[model samples]
Target chain A: MSDPDRVLLCYCTCPNPASAQHLAETLVRESLAACVNRIAGIQSTYRWKGEVTSDSEELLLIKTTAGQFEALKERLLAVHPYELPELIAVPVERGHAAYLEWVRAAGGD
Target chain B: MSDPDRVLLCYCTCPNPASAQHLAETLVRESLAACVNRIAGIQSTYRWKGEVTSDSEELLLIKTTAGQFEALKERLLAVHPYELPELIAVPVERGHAAYLEWVRAAGGD
Candidate 1:
């Protein structure tokens, strides 16, 4: 099981700005994320179904607490356009204390 | 100690396109990173030195292996202009297998 209070930076990619924006808003509105940074115009290259595919995708850096990850993942997989969306959570080992505390509180219980 | 073979996503921010591009190129060229995705025009808000600050910055999503992290961190701190640059390494628990392999191989031993 994931830790309940650890700060996490979850990385997710969307096909375009519309989807990215929608997802970001949903996460924040639901208090599943403290904040979401949308970075547009990223080119991703990876292997898919035995072929190397490259495409333009927008990246979402979602900030939340670990306890929210499961719910966040569920919401993402349910609403995301991709059949298999990438949701990778990386722990925040060190960050500004005040900022991290804000994230934990803003992320909700 | 970190797991040397694990794939890692290192989050970093640059003040502008020139710096972001330069840092990305250097990391890839030096094998400190397998790939670096430059996302321009991001706004970051955080608490710094007892004050809350917000700034427009470019984000660098660096892909490398844990083995290269220390060297990568050293290089980033040495070259990054900020008195204290943010270098957060998030371990990749899951990824496309081939892509992860590419990262580990390209990141060097």
Candidate 2:
């Protein structure tokens, strides 16, 4: 059995290239993340004003340990600009041995 | 420049399809996320034991507004089995207006 509290996935997005780099560095310096993967060109869809719409966006995948979640969130809250910033985590059920251990070591101070 | 305080990206992962579906449902039902995009066949590379290793994994791309983030995380933590879940958030600076509005409405109870 895996401890839900042990690992975390920090998902984020930015309008441009600049903010993405800024946030990634902030998380790392604060010891809230081990690595940040910045991916460009993501298309998204949602309903607004009773209408469905879509747009292009950038995505960031942050890898960190569970223990650092709270602090990571705080750092994010302090700098993000949306009325409600997005922050969601998924439980990692199973994975390859080397990757799991890599995550453990990388997401540490 | 945009305010570094609004919008967020929530990222998480699971070892298989079943867990991914479960978490996506949990987030949507709880209104922490408006939608979850489940993508299969992600190849990951990382270093462990001072050596680089790689593997294939599944990916979950979740979309939710800022307000729903914390609650969404709580729900994910409640059911995840991993010692650490992947949770990362990025700021949304510029995007299609329709999509932004949609995110705001869908992420609410």
Q: What C-alpha lDDT values do all the predictions have?
A: 0.81, 0.66
TM-score of chain B of 2: 0.82
DockQ of every candidate: 0.19, 0.06
Pairs with steric clashes in candidate 1: none
* TM-score for each of the candidates: 0.60, 0.50
Candidate 1 segments exceeding 4 Å error: B1-5, B10-89, B93-109
Model 1 TM-score relative to the real fold: 0.60
Q: What's the lDDT for residue A57 in model 1?
A: 89
Q: Which ten residues in a row have the lowest lDDT in candidate 1 chain B?
A: B93-102
**CAPRI-style quality class for the chain A–B interface of candidate 2:** incorrect
Task: List iRMS for all predictions.
Answer: 4.9, 9.3
lDDT of 2 by residue, B34-87 (tens): 766565567878786899998666666777766677777888888876777788
Model 1 CA lDDT for position B108: 56
Residue-by-residue lDDT tens digits, candidate 2, A58-93: 677887766666677778777876555655554455
